[model samples]
Every structure is written in structure tokens, then in C-alpha cells.
Target: MENDPQAQEEILEELVMALKAGGQSFILGILLTSILWGIATAQIWHYYRVYRDDSKSLKRFVFLLLLFNLAQFITIIYGAYYWLITCRLPGNYPKVLDVTK
Candidate 1:
């Protein structure tokens, strides 16, 4: 089933586009991204806390935001991919084969 992975990827891409269109899916994406952003920000905070004396290693808010957004983007893509894969069409489900003859 070489095509299965491609089909799943396509479904995920479509799900992302459709979700971006509006409603609950869009809201869910926003919430998930925001949560990721928050977590990334906290990580930055922790790093700063441990390296407060290292001026050269200090992180700027803008840079942290950029990193956080990048992480959020990746998280959203992965979430969409798996969500679509698991929420497949009923007909797409695997059918059991009878081996006994």
C-alpha cells in the first residue's frame, strides 16, 4: 500500500486548508498553536533563568517569538497530519480478510 501514505498526506493537507477556512477546526488549530507558543516561551524563560549571568547567551523576545512561531507551525502541521489520518473516511478503514478456505 505505497499509495496509502501519499493519500494520508493529501488528506492532511486538505484538512489544514479546510480548517483554515473557518469554524471549529480553525479554532482548534489556533488553540493548539497558542499552547505550543506558550510552552516555547516558557522554555525560553527557563533558559534565561539558568543563564542569567551569561549576557552573550541571553535571548531576545523577538527571537524567542520567532522560534516559538516556527515550533507552532511544525506542531500544527504534525497535528493536522495525524488528525486527518485517524479521522479517515469509513470506506478507507481496513477490511479483514478471511484466510480459511
Candidate 2:
């Protein structure tokens, strides 16, 4: 059976409404992820500081891990902002999704 454009539009509208409905939850998720990332990075830094004189290689590894985690944190923050903007601004939704199709 062929898909009807009208049905597809209806489905899309419903999906958008659902996303809008969950806007608060999305914000909460973003907040929680950021808080958890901060806590993890803090713990890593604490360990690194405590064991700074343990080994040269271990220090380097911990430094690298911290850098990687920092990069990941930045990426996640950007993604969360993008998601929030996309979901909160319904006017751009069609244009954003249109590019995929």
C-alpha cells in the first residue's frame, strides 16, 4: 500500500506535538547529563591530582582521558542546545526535517 501524504503530515504533526509536550523532560535530561558529566570529570581530576607523582605514563594517560572527556562534554552540550532549539522552535521543524528527505 502506498503512503498518503495527508496521513504522513498528520503523523508528523502528532510527533511534533508530542515533542513539544515533552520539552520540560528534555530540559531535565540535558541538565542531568551535564551534572553527571561534571561529577565524573571532577572525580577524574581529583584522582589525577592525587596520583600526579605515581608514574609519568599514568599521568599522561589521565591527562589524555581528561581532554577526551572535556571534548565529549562540549559535544554533548552543543547537541543538547541544538535539540532544545529544534524542539522548542516549531517553525524550523519542517525545514530541518525536509533536508533529510
- Candidate with best lDDT: 2
Clashes of each: 0, 0
Clashing pairs in 2: none
What is candidate 2's lDDT per residue for 28-56, written digit by digit as tens? 87788778878888888798778767788
**Consecutive 10-residue window with the lowest summed lDDT within model 1:** 92-101
RMSD of each: 11.3, 6.2
Error of 2 at 71 (Å): 1.5
The models' CA-based lDDT, in order, is 0.58, 0.69
**lDDT tens per residue, model 1, 4-97:** 8887566556555544453367458767777877787787778777877765534565466767688768777676664455434444333211
TM-score of each: 0.37, 0.59
The runs of at least 3 residues in candidate 1 whose Cα sits more than 4 Å from the true structure, single-residue gaps closed, are: 1-21, 55-101
